[model samples]
Target: MTNYKRKKLDAFLSLSFCRLLSVIYIVHLPHLDATIEVTLRSMVASTFSMEYPKANRSFTSMSHLRRQLLPKTKDMPSGTGFGLMRLFTRKSPRSHSSKKKLPAGEQESESTTSTMSSTETTSIHRYDSGRRYNARQDIPYLLPNDEEENDRAHQQHWMINVAFGSNFDAPVQDALEKGIEVLDSGCGPATWTLEMAEKYPNSTFNGTDISPRFPQTIKPPNCHFFIHNIVDPAPFPDSTFMFIHQRLLSLGILENEWDKALADLMRTLKPGGWIELLEISYAQYENAGPKVTLLMQSVVTYGKSKGLNPGAAHVLDDMLTQAGAVNISSRRVAIPLNHGGKLGDLFWDDFKDIFMALYPVVGRLHSDLADIEEYKRFLDACKTECSEHQTALYWYRSCGQKPSNDE
Candidate 1:
C-alpha cells in the first residue's frame, strides 16, 4: 500500500481501537471503583487526543454517546462524566499552596468563603465499602446515595406499584387530577415523585431528601426536589400541601422520632388532606430461612443500636391517631421473594442490593462475616435459602386525613 494510504489506515485502526475501549469502559462504569474509572478515562482521553490531535470534536461526540448508552434512571444526574472528560482538555490551575497565606486574625474574603462553601457541599457525601453514603451525622439514613442504590430504588418503586396496584391508596385521586400540592418526604431518587408528576400534570409535586441524589435537570415541570431532612421541622408553611407521602423511612427515623416526623408531615399537610406512609416490616419476613433469619436479626439489632425502629410499620396507626389525624386506615401486602416468578425475581434482586449496601454496618455487627468476599458468599447462601424456604416480605401502607377547621 502507498505511504499515504498506509498512514490513513493506521490512524483509522487506532481510532477504532480507542473507541472500542471507551465503549467497554462506559458499559462497566457502574461496577468500577472511582480511582479505576478515573484512570481508565485518563488513558482513553490521552490516547485518543494523542492520535487525533485535531479530533476534539470526536471526543465531545464520545461524551454524548456515553450519556446516551448509559442506563438511565429517573434521577440520573445530567452530564455526569462530562466534567471529568473536560479535565483532560483544560490546563490545571496553579496549586493553592503557592498562594500567599492569610495573615493571623484576617478573615477570609467573600470569594474564599464561597469556595469553602462549595468544598463543604462536596464533602457532604463520603465513600464507604465502595458505596457513596450521605455523611451528615444528623441524617441517619442507612442506604448508599450512589447510582446503584438509585437503580434499586427505581426498581422498588415499580415493585410496590405492582404489588399495591397503585402508586397510592388514599382517596386523593380526584384532588390530584384537579391540581393539588403534594409532598414526597424522604424521597430518595424521586422515582415515585417523577412518575406521579407525569401521571398528573395538573398536580404539583415536591420531593425532599437529605442527599441530593435526585435529578437536577431533566424532570417534569411540575416536579421539584429539595435537599432537606424530614427529621427537622417541615420546610413548608402550615397546611401547604394537599397530600403528603413518605415511604421506607423506618430505617432513617429513630424510634422516638417517629412522632416528630409524623407531626412534621401533618404540619405541612392541608386540613382535610391525606397523608400516606409505606414501610417494610424490617426483620419480620415470613417463612425466612436460618441464614435469612440470622442476617435480618443482625440488621434489626444494628438498627436498634442506632435507636431506629425496625417495627415502625406496626405502630403507624397509633402514631397518626396521636398526631390528631382522623379516619386512619392501613393495608398490608406480602411481596414474595425468589419464588413468585418475575415479581419474586425483582424483589430478590432488590433485597440483594440492600444486603450488599449494608455490608459496612452488617460486617461490623456480625464478626463472622467481616471479610466482604465471605459476606458475599453468605449472601449467596441466603439467596438459596430464600428460594428453598419461600421467603416473603410484608409492607404496610397506612394513611390518615387531617381534620378540617369545621371538624
Candidate 2:
C-alpha cells in the first residue's frame, strides 16, 4: 500500500481501538478502581485530542460524542467528560514573541487587547450558488460578502443618503470637524466609513466586521478596518469614541444578541457620545402586493428560525433605552419602491439584490424558490407588484447619547 493509504488505515485502526476501549471502560467503569478509571479517562481524552485538535473539533460534535460515550453517573461529576475533552483539546496560549504589537500611540487596554488577540484567527468563508458568505457559525447574516454584494452596499449607501438627506443625524458634526474618534460597527465594504473619513479628515474612523471586504491598501489615512465580530465584546477600550455608527445589522444580529451587542457598543462610547443605528424594517414593507408579501413572509420565517427579529427597526428606541442610553431619538423615512422614479428604481434594484443573495437561505425554507430561475421569476413578480401597488419600505434611524459621568 502507498504511504497515504497506510496512514489512513492506521488512523482508522487507531480510532476503532479507541472506540472499543471507550465502550469497555464505560461498561466496567463501576467495577474499576478510582486510579484505573482516571487513567482510562485520561488515555481516551489524550487519544481524542491527539487525533483531532480543538480547531478541527466543534463543540456541538464533541458534546454529542461525550453524550454517546459517557452516561451521567453518581460517581462521576457533571460535565466531567465534556470538561476533560475541552481540557485535553485546548491549545496552548501564544507566546509573547508571536503576539503582534500595536503601533505607537495606539495602545489598548488589557480587555481590548484580549478581545483583539482572540479575533486574530480568521474565519473561513463559504461559497454557495456562486456567492460568498461569512463563515461565522454563530451569526445568521444571510448575505453574500463578494464584490457584487459590495457594489450593492455602495448603492444602498447612496440610496440611504438620498432618502435621509445626510450620512448622519447625530449632533457630532462639530466634533467630527474638529477631531475625535469614531467607530462604524458592522461596516460592510466601509462605504459610509470611507466617505465620512474623506468628508471629515480631522476625525479618525474605525470600522469592524467579521468579513474583510473593506479596502486595505487604498483606504484613506483617517480610515481603518478590522476583521472583528460585533456579537462579541467591542475590541476597543471603554469610552473610546465620540461617535459610533452601526447600520443594516438586522439580518446579522439575533434578537437575544441585540441587547449585548448594544451594551458593548455603549461600553466603547465616550461619555455623552452619540451612537446612531440605521436599519430597514425587514419584511414590513407598506402596500406590498401578494407576490411581494409572500417573498417577505419567507424571509421573516427564515429569520425567525434563526432567532432573528425581522422587525428590529421598530424596536431600536426601546433597545437603546434598555442599554442605558440617554436622549434617545429616532427618525423613520418611508422610501418609495419601484414608483418613486430614480430613487425608487435604485431601491428596487437593491431589494432585488438582497433577495437574490438570500436564495441559499430562503431557498432551503421555500421549495418554490429552490431554483435560481424560479427565484428570479418570483423577484420579477414582486417588482411588478411593487410597481403596481406603490410599495414603500420604512427606514429607521435612531440616535442616543451615553450618559455623562456626572449624570
State TM-scores per candidate: 0.72, 0.69
Give the Cα lDDT of each candidate. 0.73, 0.73
CA lDDT, candidate 1, residue 325: 94
| Candidate 1 lDDT, 1-407, residue by residue in tens | 96535654665666666677666775686798867766766565445432221231222223322333334434345555434332222221222112233334544332222211121123345445555667577777788886567657766777788799999989999999999999999888777787788778899999998888776754566888898888889779999998999999988998889888888888888899999999998767799988888777877888999999888888889889989899999999999988887678768878887988787677777787877678889999988998999999889999999999999
lDDT of 2: 0.73
Can you tell me which runs of candidate 1 are displaced by over 4 Å?
1-122
lDDT by residue (1-407, candidate 2, tens digit) is: 96535654664565566677677775685698866766765665445432221201221123234544554444566545534433222222222112343334543333212211221222355445555566557768878786668657766887888899999999998999999999999988777887788678899999999888876655556788898888898789999999999998888889999999999999999998999999998767789888777767877888888898888999999999999999989999999989887689768878887887776666777776766677778888888889999999899999999999999
Model 2 / residue 377 / CA error / Å: 1.5
Alpha carbon lDDT at 34, candidate 1: 66
How many pairs of residues in model 2 come into backbone collision?
0
Local error of candidate 1 at 51, Å? 34
Local error of candidate 1 at residue 166 (angstroms): 0.7
Q: What does the lDDT read for residue 275 in candidate 2?
A: 94
